[model samples]
Target: MSTLLSLNAQSRDADHMLEQALQQWGGERDLWIFGYGSLIWRPDFDFSERCSAHVHGWHRALKMWSTINRGTPQCPGLVFGMLSGGSCQGMVFRIPRDYGEAVMRKLWLREMPNAVYDPRWLPCKTLQGPVQALAFTLSRQSPHHTGELEPDEYRRIFSQARGIYGTTLDYAQATFDELQRLGIADKALQRLLSYADCDRSVESVAI
Candidate 1:
């Protein structure tokens, strides 16, 4: 992981980060973005097409604690991670070359606007072969970045946390649904959900 991964604080400069990205990926025509989180199911991009891609050294983990979404400010919520360790199978979207910059900008604005994410480029093995794609990692600088949390705490927030987006339950439901539909039931994700406080409801509703 690069130092950028350590930039999980809430005070990053969005414009500057975008400019750096533009420079890094400048002149690229068709763009492939690897999505392992909410993007796996709910892609907010207008893409020309999508294909499967495999990225190594990272798998989804519920390593992040958020006070604003799944959990309250005091209790906080938990979110998944593309943490380094194993490989992740996810979809890669092909965005138009001319619109790549704009589309990338939209992605950054949606995810990295707070500067809490360290966006980086990684090589994704796509149908076409290996291709570089944009991905975001949590910053170590973030006060909210918890390397580990108690199982009970993980469950309480996961069981009750909600946000402007929705409840933590909704998040789990969405991810489980998407992964199962894709026939990619990631074991790590299942284990994370297993730590949640609500089982009866999750057992019936988890897809």
Candidate 2:
């Protein structure tokens, strides 16, 4: 019980971090958020504008374990995380200054529950121009960073792991479908989806 309480306390510290970051903003202008994964399809927050944006020095990869929203501790699911390397093409959202605090609070609760992600302000290039946007990136040293895994491991997680939001397979499919609609092609994600579909077919045959 003490351990659980301590964990919860640590998670709440993310809220404090959010407050500190906001203080530095000075409420002078709009806030921009860069989304490379689920946020692309389900922002769940009000934004004044959004546009296709690119960020250098980092790329999106399914490198994090989702032990809450997409799966449990026993059967962890996979999620996207920004890692240092190539570039990533994603979406950047502009939140009105008046709404920045509220929207950021909601985002913090959604993404920083375990404080596993390191939120940073990154410069994103949009069709309009360059904008400094907040992005959640994962450190390679983090325990939740999956680095690399076997195809079978991914198949098992997609087939069997589920959580409050839904199955990991569904999450991956939604992200892939959304990216396709946006005219973005991700070959690695395509292969992952193929593995998931193959797993489902095998299960259907067994049933």
Candidate with top lDDT is 2
> Each model's number of backbone clashes?
7, 0
Assess each prediction's global lDDT (C-alpha) against the native: 0.73, 0.85
Model 1 C-alpha lDDT per residue in residues 50-99, reported as the tens digit of each score: 77888887766767766665667866666665667678888788887898
RMSD, each candidate, Å?
Answer: 3.9, 5.8
Regions more than 4 Å wrong, model 1: 1-11, 201-207
TM-score of each: 0.85, 0.90
Candidate 1 collision pairs:
6-140, 7-139, 8-139, 66-77, 70-161, 71-76, 71-77
Q: What is the lDDT of residue 28 in candidate 2?
A: 88
